[model samples]
Target: MKIKNITTFLLKVPLGDQRFYSSQCAFPERNSLLVRIETDTGICGWGESGQYGPGEPVATFIETVLKPRLIGKNPLDINVLWEDMFTGIRDFGRKTTGIEAMSGIDIALWDIAGKFYDKPVYELLGGAFRKKVLGYATGCYYRGEDVLDYKKSLQNLKDEASGYIDAGFTALKIKVGLLHVKEEMERIAAIREAVGNDIILMVDANHAYNFHTAKRIGKFLEEMNVHFFEEPVVPENIHGYKTLRETLNLAIAAGENEFTRFGYLELLKNECLDIIQPNIGCAGGFTEAKRIEALASAYHVQVIPHCWGSGIALAAALQYCATIAPSPHTAFECAPENSPMIEYDKNVNPLRDSLLTETFNVNDGFVQIPDGPGLGVEINMSVLKKHLTKT
Candidate 1:
């Protein structure tokens, strides 16, 4: 079917007293830019462009520049359209902004493909490797007053970890890089003590350190039996990544900011990291992420998709997790170890939990994959209207 109409929304769900503070800064709201494509045959598809430090850049770019080019193209010719957009926007956003917009457009096309063929996107990606995916709660951020009070911070960490455990989550992730080394250590220590030995914990610095500090933090995390060190250092130095990997015993994971296969290829060629984290919504959607998985597989690297957006993004990630072949490595396995577990953001978001007809059901820390056509998420227009507000 041909493309008919395109719509965009920049959604921001206001934060409560428990605002999420990451390595960069405190997040005032849970924000994401959603893209919807309606086909000529009356079939429609949904996608999301990841909203991070920058606000609404992709949505505006898509609406002003890319929408005209995509108006009449065949929804099934995703590859052709992707390339057309890739080369056409060289002067502006070929790799960075270009791919970010194309990511949502490509995902919408895949949704159309799945709807037309009466199959799930994972099946269209050569079928599911497993029926369910293990999920990890990504929370434990430093809150408002907790940021200033050590006791309050420790209590917040304890409460967050206990809540995850009580909710049947076997794995959890916490924010770092915003605190001093000692404070970071204390936070991890408290969480570990609270959760006991059975729970798996992961820490993310969000690219907050130099090579030396990254190495030191990584070592500390390893002592606490942390799953992996995420974005420990800035991504500019791929060679530094080699050094970081060698200096630390824990797995080195990054690539959340990276865009296309070429960007990922640069990381793989340098032996820079052990795990590749691709945000499907930002890394050119399923069309590009599938190629990234293949490219990483050849390097013997594991792909643990970085997911923190609307349900559209979560659904896309679930499709990727279901189809990816299990990693042979120690910590990033799929079925048994739940290696590269789905990064389930524990933040407050109406788009994540209420925008879909059937929200994901997380039970005993394992989330069963959606089986409906396309990405398996049926849009809830009424709820969508409720949460629709500008950032």
Candidate 2:
């Protein structure tokens, strides 16, 4: 079946001040770009591109630029279509609105292909090597306006982590680097004591510190036996990463901000990271991320895929993780605690809980891969209409 039409929906889903998150300092209000591809065969596919990039400006780019190029094309030719979009926008800059628009269209193409073949997107990629993927909790962010109270925050984290472990999470991740090194060490110790030795504990600094601070903290984290440290320094600082990697034995991970395969090639080439965390929505959608994953595999790096968006973003990430075989490239998947086995948005994002007919339910710290076609879960249009941004 040929592609009939491509449409873009820019939705401003309300995510009330999440207890575990302080709205991204960049985009406090989360906005997502959802792409729907309809084909002549009466099939529809869905995909989510980078949400916070356009801030509603993406709708214009999608309609004016991408729509004209995609209207009558074959949806199954994902590689060529992706290349066409990539090449067409090269002069426009790589990580701007143009690439973000391309990401939405590219994801929709994959979704369309999955529905066309009457199989899940992961199956099309390479039938699932696993029917279920294990998840790690990622919501130990500091609460309260005046920086997380050190002792109180430690207890709070311990409490939150206890709940996650009781709910069946085998692993959990906490936000760090914003606190003093000694205080952060105490918090990690408390969490470790709460979760015991079997559970995997990870930390994310979100690139908050410089190399020296990162090194100092990494050494402390190693003593605490933390699983891995994420984005200790800015993503562009390869020199910092190399220094940090050499300075500490703990596995270093980053790359949610990276855009394309070219962006990832540098990370892989430098051997700066022990794990690569590419957000499917931001890192050129599934097309380029798969390429990045392949490159990571060549270098023996693990992929833990970053998912910090709404439910659709989580679904897309789940599908991507399912397709990755039990290779030397995959370590574990990050699972959020707010909902089921997916990146449960413990916040009030309407799209996170109310926009899907069937939300991904996590059981025993593992989420089953979607067997339905396309991204696997059907979008609830009623919820979509209610939450769709009208600007």
Candidate 3:
């Protein structure tokens, strides 16, 4: 089908006073950019772009910069269109916005392809390795106004950890490096104590440490039997990653900020990570992420997508998780092993949790991949309208 028009809706929903704190900053609100592509045959598809901070700029880029070039082109020529888009922003030389915009468009095209073929997006890739994927909680962030208040923060995290277990998540990722090493250790200790030994506790430092510090913190986590350590060092520091990976036995996870398949290859070639966490939305959508997964597959590295956005993004991530072969050979079986787990963001955000008439919820620690044609992402336009930030 020929492309007719492209539109973007910028959305923002407040998270109230309950701040979601990571190592770098505290976010009191969640923002997203949704891309809609309509075709001549009356088919429509959806994709989400990363404007988690400034939605308007990315939305404007999608319209002013991408629209003219896309109209009347074949919707199926995804690689050709994606290459064309890169040329449009060649002067910028790998800006995250350009890559993020390309990600949205590519994912939408894949959704269109899936609809055209009358199959789920995962089937279009190569049939599902699994029909449902387990999700890990990404909710234990510093909730108090004073983040360094370890006593309160630890109690709040312990409470959140219990909630995750109650909500049916066996695996949970908690934000760290917001306070001193001793306090952070105490926080991890409390959550582990609350959730007990069977539950998986993963720590994400969000690139908050150097080699010495990352090693020290990682050693503490290993003592607590933490599942993995995420982004302990900055993404650009390849040596730092190599050192950390070499130094620690804990599964080293990185790559959410990683841009494309090529960027991922650099990490893979060096064996810099035991698990790679690429956000399907940010790391070049399905097209590039599939390529990233293929590369990871060759290395036997696990790919647990870093999902954090609206329902559109969550839907896209679910589709991806469905297709990925459970690590080792090319199939998924319910074993208590290192397989793909969906990074379900449990932080407060209605834009992701409530925007769709048919919402995604973690049930018994797993989420069933959408069985409908395309990504199976159907949103209540009224809900979209309610959260639409007027530009």
Candidate 4:
């Protein structure tokens, strides 16, 4: 029906040191900025935006600035709502923290539309192309102290990777680019050996290197049969990505840091990457992400969807990936191998686990798609209230 009200919450979730990569050890991550959209018909939709940049001010941006513009708008008119949100702030232009605030509302609107149509969000978007998506374990990071010894790092990787393998994950991603090339190489080699040649191994540097270093690391990864190298260089350097793509034999993946389809167009034109990783909550939700997927498909790019936030972000990404067809070639930058795995965060979050009445389950490396109306997961308001912070 019509929109009734909007609410926003900045929820902070604590993670165990072992739950995330080593670099994030000191910080208690703010994690997710949660949004709730209520419709007149009593249907509610849930969405998330990562609580990055500045602080809780993002919540204020959504409520004071964006919410007033969205009231009484048709939740089903996602395209119109997205355009209104984008154009309303065009003077400020795109790529602002404001876009991140709009992202949460846009996602909630899509979730509402799915509920209105009495179908899962993917079904409303044109039905699912795959039932279950394969997922990769993504929290494996260096666990060494300031000493930075490769021995401890290597053992930590083996021990952590083996846990994921034992948990039935078919693929796992580790953080790289922090240590020397030789040390990074040894770490990857050890994980590959520990998991055997069958399991897929992906590495992300989080934009920690230069073009020369990416090329050097890419060369080594090619020899190791690394599935993909993510954000090898800074995110702004699409040209560096092109050079790395041309120089390296391994597949290149990025785009978690990218905003919308417009940003992705620059990457696609370069033809440097083979997989495109669009974060549903951050990159303009299902509305714009699906559009980006279509653009990537024309160039024959695969979409693995970068998801590193809370459960709402994970569920939203899964809904989009379930419906978008995989390109004949791999996705642009961060595509996984066969079975089309999604990125799953193994970190701690009461919202990720307890917010939903039924938790999403992973078995044998693949996660089944949600079948209920909307995002297919109901929000536990009690849990939300328990975790919500007062302004």
lDDT to native, each model: 0.84, 0.75, 0.85, 0.78
Ranking by lDDT: 3, 1, 4, 2
C-alpha RMSD of candidate 4: 2.9
lDDT of each residue in 109-188, candidate 1, tens digit only: 88889999999999999998777778889988877665756566687679888999999999888888887888888988
Q: TM-scores of the models, in the given order?
A: 0.95, 0.90, 0.96, 0.93
CA lDDT, candidate 4, residue 139: 62
Candidate 2 achieves a global lDDT of 0.75
* Residues forming the 10-long window of minimal summed lDDT in candidate 3: 329-338
Error of 1 at 180 (Å): 0.8
The per-prediction tally of clashing pairs is 2, 2, 0, 12
lDDT, candidate 1, at 367: 86
Q: Alpha-carbon error at 22 in model 3, in Å?
A: 1.2
* Model 1 CA deviation exceeding 4 Å by range: 329-339
State the local distance difference test value for candidate 4.
0.78
Model 2 residue pairs with clashes: 136-335, 341-362
The C-alpha RMSD of each candidate to the native structure, in angstroms, is 2.1, 3.7, 1.7, 2.9
lDDT of 3 by residue, 237-272 (tens): 899898888988788999988888888999999989
